[model samples]
Target: MQQDERQRKMKIMEVRMREIELSLSNVKLLLREKVAQLKEQLHKNGKADVLIGNLYDENDVLLEVLEKTKQRHIILEKKNFLLEEKISSLNKIMCDLTPPPSLPYHY
Candidate 1:
């Protein structure tokens, strides 16, 4: 009878061991799936980061171009003012060099 009881206990232990092994296998599979998902997410995030960086670089270049354009506009405005002054001076000189016509009247 003791031998029979021992045999029954051993059987129960074997069954429990099998259940634990199945549970461990399931946990391992879930872990592997989660790791794979995380890796994929990391890859996508890396690509997004690179894209954002490139956009920032492009924005910086555009800002530089805009600054240069503004400076050029200012320079042109100054040049235009100088040219206008020179043209006015030349017109005055030309008017002064011309002779006035004389009118004759009999009283």
Candidate 2:
């Protein structure tokens, strides 16, 4: 009876060891899959970051151009105002120099 019991316990231990080995192999396979997914995600994120950086640079350049255009517009507006004033003054002088039409006398 003692020998039979020892033999049964040894058989159970061997089965358990096989099960543990299978579980370890499954875990290793899962870890390898997860590592591959993470690497792919990292590569995609790097490309997105570079594109965003380029857009930011372009936006900065556009802003600078807009500012310069706004300044030039302001300068032109000021010059136009001065020209209008001069034209108005010249018109007044021309009106003063012209003689008024005489009215017809009623009998």
Task: Score every model by TM-score.
Answer: 0.63, 0.81
| lDDT (tens digit, per residue) of candidate 2 on 39-88 | 99999999999999999999999999999999999999999999999999
Once fitted onto the true fold, the runs of candidate 1 whose alpha carbons sit more than 4 angstroms away are: 76-107
Candidate 2's C-alpha runs over 4 A off are 104-107
| Native-structure RMSD, model 2 | 2.1
In the predicted model 1, the residue pairs found to clash are none
- Give candidate 1's total backbone clashes: 0
Residue 53 alpha-carbon offset, candidate 2, angstroms: 1.4
Question: What's model 2's TM-score?
Answer: 0.81
lDDT of 2: 0.98
Which pairs clash in model 2?
none
lDDT of 1 at 107: 85
lDDT of each: 0.98, 0.98
- Candidate 1: global Cα-lDDT? 0.98
TM-score of 1: 0.63
